[model samples]
Target: MSTTGLYQDQHLEINLPQAMVSVDEQRLILTRKEFELLAMLSANEGEILPRNVLLDRIWGYSEEIRTRTLDVHIRRLRKKLGLYGDSYIQTIFGVGYRFQRFREPRALISYQSPLFAATA
Candidate 1:
């Protein structure tokens, strides 16, 4: 199995495993650390992973690394995600962040095709 996560849309796609991020009409590029941070957060979507946890998981630092580093990285990630970033990822006060599983409202579906149908 692959250890990559993908955040995509009609115009853009981010490949976490390849450490490549592509925006619409733009080139895909990212550093290793940036990709790692994004992958870790994305892997634990909807969980407000604390700063220490993120540092430990991504940087392998045990509560000793500067917290600002994490903050900086998160800010960068948010910028990279663009408009959809706010919808997918959220910051919890005094804690950390949560990657929300993008849930498209059923009402928005105009067709009843099987591909769009939900199965339990």
Candidate 2:
């Protein structure tokens, strides 16, 4: 089994000590908040972390505090990671987000963006 980041079978790797993340062996640059966010999600792979929990953990803010920072961070992270498939983080809609797990190494086809529908 290939253990890259927080979980096995994942192509991405997060070196917390180095504060770095690599996708498909390519290094990625992220802001401080972005790195923290990725680390949290990677640490809790397969588990859905609520927006409130994420904010509290990463930003050290109470759940009652209102902010769209998490959303912005997530968007930026996704863009940097070039993530688009089920193997990456997933939105739970009105709830939270989950870092999905990979069962095996995937091919380019698996990275197909959901933004583009399959043309029959």
Query: After aligning candidate 1 to the native by TM-score, how far in Å is the CA of 19 from where it should be?
Result: 3.6
The Cα local distance difference test for each model comes to 0.72, 0.78
TM-score of each: 0.65, 0.73
Number of the predicted model whose lDDT against the real structure is largest: 2
Compose the digit string of candidate 1's lDDT tens values, residues 23-60. Answer: 66576455677778777777776678998888888878
TM-score of the candidate numbered 1?
A: 0.65
Candidate 1 stretches greater than 4 Å from native: 1-14, 23-27, 64-66, 103-120
lDDT of 2 by residue, 29-86 (tens): 8999988887888788778999999999899999789998899898888888785434
Indicate the worst ten consecutive residues by lDDT in candidate 2.
Answer: 1-10
Q: For model 2, which pairs clash? A: none
